[model samples]
Target chain A: MKATNLSTPKFCSALQILGLALMVFWFAAPVLQAAETLKLSARLVWGTNRDKSADDELKAMTPKLKSKFVNIFKWKEYYEISKKTFQFPKHEGKQIRMSKNCEIIMKLLDKDTLQVQVIGEDQLQRTVKHPLKPILTDGDLFVVGGDDKDSYGDAWFLVITHPNLGKEHKKEE
Target chain B: MNEKLVIQIQAYLDGELSAEARLQLLARLEKDSEARELCDSLKAEQSLLKDVGEKDHELPVAHSYFWKAISDEILPHPSPRNQTRHKQTAGAFQRWSAWLVPGGVIACIALVVFQKGLLDDVLDGIKSTGKKAARRAPSFHEIDSQQQNAGFISFRSESEGVSVVWISNY
Candidate 1:
């Protein structure tokens, strides 16, 4: 009786087919996600556009600033720097010192809003509420700035948001 | 032809039997041709093993050439000095390659940061003076309920490339 060799052509072909199927599944899985869901992100940026452009004028309406584009408080950047700088269970008085003797006082107003008070070296204090929108869509920019008029400003709070940008666009509240 | 006699003959050749058992085996060997043949075979095998183990014994072929062919096929031997040099080069390469991981991570971070700076420049350039109405109105539901409760309203305009959010109470 002839013994059968385990490395037969049919067995190898079956293994190759299985391996090919796994590769196909691995590559195709992410593409099969339901295209209906919308993804969004929001950022609260506090910077002086220091530029003389009218848009910077509108965005940076604060008066008496030192340098342009001085990012005093950015929501994402601040929190990241703060969490790393401070210990756990952060308190109200937990402050992050910015450029030109500007100190940022953080307070959680609500689940969706954070109150940041930017006090400049000149003792000019500007308080702005940064709202954390739960749902963000594409191309949505939310800007919250201080009432700065001249090229020099104390601080500006900007929030960029993107909302309900989905393929279906079936209005989701 | 008896199996017991055959065993006894082998035991006698090996000197494992007592004197009385040896004498019995000798008598049986005289009577049994099969027992005698078995004893002769065992003796011949013992002598053959001795001859093979003896240093003066000659092989059918040259031993050095025979073993060298087998060693070449099993393992190709390189010069020890060259092997040491190759290993040192490989080790140096491995040590250098170890730095590549952190280097790659830093490079990726720098690229992202550089790209972000470029994007910020472009966005800043695009943000000029404009107060035109937004091309698309923000969906009412897109407004967060928390912001509404706080008297805050968010208005986004991509054309303006700026989002204007304000508090009504202020």
Candidate 2:
């Protein structure tokens, strides 16, 4: 007996539908994921050689987070001056005040790209644009910091990250 | 009797000879008794064979079954060339069908990786443009400092997977 013919209309229709579905998924996956507003955590951290901050309201940084800062900078201890978690739509910017002296304006330039403007003492200090997907997906840190004007020897950091990035990374593992 | 003459007589009886040849052979047969006798025997044998062939013979199985068996044997045994052509067609179909899904998947993955800038990072790492470039693993599209007193330095630590942008106060 002859084998079944695949050139028939039924078979061709099925293949066409399958191809259309895959193409839709290819384009739609990123759009669907990017459609939701981005949730981010911005922290104002004080990095100093002193073991503790003079202000009692400041909280000590998490051990896992402190280890990351310790490995990169010369700071002996890290204290969180303020931390804010917020969500903003794509291609738009949001202003978050982490502390009285430090605030940051974050803009989602694209799905995985972000532009950050750091304002310290009501002055625009720096503007940086970086890809946020790799950092967030990989559970990495994006830190913007400089020497403190009030305290000459100490430095301050504006640490931005995805709040759920670590949990997602752990799930992946 | 000569074998050649017997063959000629058979041809003459079968009407296979041309008109001239037929007349010549007929004249020889009239004169030759041996040729006449051989021709008669050959004609009688042909008639008997024809009768036997025309006689109805019953098959052990039904007629349809008998014919079907022969068709089954002959139909399944296709010519070697046709079989090769069929195999080639099937092989091509299988190859295309097999690769369709995987090829689509690979294309999707490549697109996603490219869109995510992972491919660029990999390429940059491979090129290792400079000392600073090699260390700058963070995929930054742009960076600017608004104040003259403040400047920014950015680098990535591959070991910790961390990107640091240090805003230095000069």
Candidate 3:
């Protein structure tokens, strides 16, 4: 049998391999970037002048976080009714139930943005999009709150935060 | 020669005319010499083109060289000094073009990474500024409440590092 000229120069073959690798990386860059998920924590807090919560399961708010609310609003005490820690994928929405009557839908709009919809009594109360970068980097908080309809002068707050940053803050505390 | 008769005769030659139209065209072709001549010329031209297409024809030079020669002939010839300058310019252009695709790809990747980093930095700066500002300042980019029974107000206390959206009457 005649010998076939299948041999390619080593340099050319190496360059070809490098090119193939670069092409694969170029195509995969976006997908790899998109794989990153945003971790968040949402808390349903009840604000009242009363010293204690009627539900024993409810926990008092962190002193650092509650002081923030006390400075801004009229509520004397803030109690955490429910808390959820979840991950948000890019452009996808997640519905989180904070209580029987309170629900929140959060969507990761992009790398630096989050869309939040507050649902009270199965009705959409508000929709907000928050710039995520500041919240993620600066440990900023996003809260959706309203007056407690059942109780006069009582209020409810839905607070959102970056879980990692929140944990770091707690560690520092 | 009538243009209509010429078309009919051509269509009959191509076997495209209806049977009744072909018979009428054939009768006219026997009676009209000018129509017959036009039909004969169109057939001759079609046959000549087919023959030229079917015959194998080879270029005297390589395909690239052939095109280059034709382009050289069509484009103006430069002076010796100008030709050297042109070659240098072309060489530089070719070198740049070689790097253009890879450079562009790298630039795009860098831009995406940089923009993401920059966004974090800028937003951090904004938050810092908001923190340094007065109490009850807003931090959210947008807030839209759709419920008629409830109205909402949002603010951020940078000192507390907390943002609040207070919905009233809900």
lDDT of 3 at A118: 81
Docking class of 2: acceptable
What is candidate 1's TM-score for chain B alone?
A: 0.33
Clashing pairs in 3: A145-B167
Tens-digit lDDT track of model 2 for A11-100: 445567767877887778778656668788888888899767365778888777877778888989898888888888765689998877
Q: Cα miss at A150, model 2 (Å)?
A: 1.4
Better of 1 and 2 by TM-score: 2
lDDT of 2 by residue, B73-126 (tens): 766577899879888887787678677767766876887787566887788678
The deviation in Å at residue A106 for candidate 3 is 0.3
> For every candidate, what share of the true interface contacts is present?
0.18, 0.67, 0.75
Off by over 4 Å in 3: A1-15, A53-55, B1-141
Candidates 1 and 2, the one with greater DockQ: 2
Model 3 per-residue lDDT tens digits across residues A107-148: 977666689988878888788888775576667788878888
For each candidate, give its TM-score against the true structure: 0.26, 0.52, 0.60
TM-score of chain A of each: 0.31, 0.74, 0.85
